[model samples]
Target: MTQKRLTPTQFRNQLLAVMDKKHHWAWPQFAGSAISKAQLKIHFQQEYGVYVRDFPVLLARIHGTNPPMDVRRKLAENIFEEDTGKLSLGKSHPELFLTMMAGLGFQNGAFGNLTLLPASRRYRTWLDQATLNRIWLVGTAVMTIFVEGSINDRQELLHPSKARSKREIESHIKRHPLVRFHGLSPAYMDLSRAHQLVENGHRHDAYDMVVNHTTTRQDQETILTALRKSLRLWLVYRDGIARACRLTP
Candidate 1:
């Protein structure tokens, strides 16, 4: 079937529609604490190798290509927070993640030299290429909307969360898997705390940066194609990790 030309709003909806399927079959196993501690380490190791550590650098790649000034400001804010934590929690996100891991008895050295699973390697390679795309918006779409945003993105974009109070944040951390299942202290949940401080803005910025900037149908098609490709690789990546962790998917 031939494709129809769509208004920008229609095109944006299609991009978001693709995000609605980002959830993997094995997600519940991970989230529900069905995986054991050693298996959980594999999960976190793969995640750090895949995107957690280099996220700010990916945003910097887009910023380097010189997007519009307002867009640059948004990128700058996100990069600043992830790289510096000056805006939210006073430490970089990756650092906070390691701190959280410490609470679970994870050694900092364990994450130092990770060999990504085969599927994870392929997915990371795709991320490196997408962020390097000549049309900066394509890089922006993959990095921000597709990578950063989650399956809950559709709901998040439509009904952004109000900033939570301190008590609420503490309550949320008490229920975290690390805290509940692995005996991690809520004191080490600064990564989650920083996210609650800034996540809503990030979600809006992710969509608005792509949707507002993409005008031509060809760019729209290009972006949507890249996102669909990302989704497929990501699922396979999750499958690889699930198998390594011995989860039935």
Candidate 2:
């Protein structure tokens, strides 16, 4: 008998386990009262330069590739939301992030002229290379699984010990230290709004795309290899931001 391959859920869970470990770098600082406004500016500036500015294009790369109609439809929905925000919170996610940056006291047009640090530049280069040059599966995994799937409510400052309702999470997020401690207005939190609106079931969609398309053993191995490489590069990227923020880790 032929050897049994791992099921899609198993593969997805394994990948997510590794990805979760990589989040230990700066999330605590970011999601808590630890990060200052100045630190947030450094973090946002690097984030805009390295990835935020180009995320729509990354999703579009996967969309442009000849994926199945079902997958393409999902990718197109995401790209449309990223580029136009018609389906989400009514503003492009990147522009909303810049709005949050403005609330952080970064002047207008600051995000457009960002000077990327070395590790930040390397991460961007890898992102461009992976999304623009690699297979559709690789591109999808990089943009969706690696980038978008990084955050969760459980990691935040107001993380409830018990399972909280969506309304409660939103309430806590509205009073989050990033807004309350930094003195940023809640009106500029479109990024957070957009996320809460469309983030449901996203990781499942990402894994479904990969596991449904990657039929062969070789293809599965390729995705694993690419995600592993992306994770290493992502750690360096976070390290760069953490150092810039002067957080000793």
Candidate 3:
């Protein structure tokens, strides 16, 4: 008998389920513990070393593989926003992130000397290998769908203990908790504003790109395999950071 294959909806849901479980938000260090600004720097530095920088270039690598025109268009748009921040705030996401770092009192150039932890380096290596060596659809799924989509976007916007109206919730979400709780100034939260503006339908875009482009069962399986590897490596990466932060369960 032949192996059973999933429909596009099933494939999309399977990918989404993987994302739901694999989010870095589940990391214990991010769970509202009162970490000092120094700890936050460590966390951000690890993140920047692996994925925050050169993310657009990774997306462009997939886009340049000559995928279907529709997928290429979407990928191009995503790359444009990432590279130039033309869609959201006037500054690029990387630039916005650096601004936040500055607000934390680090010099603008501190991120330059940042080094990756062992697990973080491994994760970055896998990402580079997958995006560069695998099929374009697999690269797209791993880079755009798995990396960019988040299950907790809405949940993160909610206050942990407050029962507020939608308006109140939205207002509170405008400023990142990093600014309010982490001793960082709100003046450098352009990254938060950029996310609020452009992230509403990003998850759907990731799924749709993978689903629409991957009509064959083999391609869907390939994408799923890449995502599974992504999730596994990602968990280890977070564990490395969490342990470095001395976070307790």
Clashes of each: 0, 0, 0
lDDT by residue (tens digit), candidate 1, 77-134: 9999999999888999999999988888998998999999999999999999998988
The true-versus-predicted C-alpha distance at residue 63 of model 1, in Å, is: 0.5
lDDT of each: 0.89, 0.77, 0.76
How displaced is residue 177 in candidate 1, in Å?
1.8
Backbone clashes in model 1, listed as residue pairs: none
Predicted model with the maximum TM-score:
1
Model 1 has an lDDT value of: 0.89
lDDT of 2 by residue, 1-249 (tens): 644666776676666665766665677788777677778788888988888888898888878877889889889888889888888777888888878877777875777778999999998998888887557888888777877766442232124244446686578667877776777777777787777677666666776788788776666777888888888888888898898888986
Best by lDDT: 1
Better of 2 and 3 by lDDT: 2
For model 1, give the 10-residue run with minimal summed lDDT. Answer: 1-10
Any idea how many clashes model 2 has?
0
Pairwise TM-score winner, candidates 1 and 3: 1
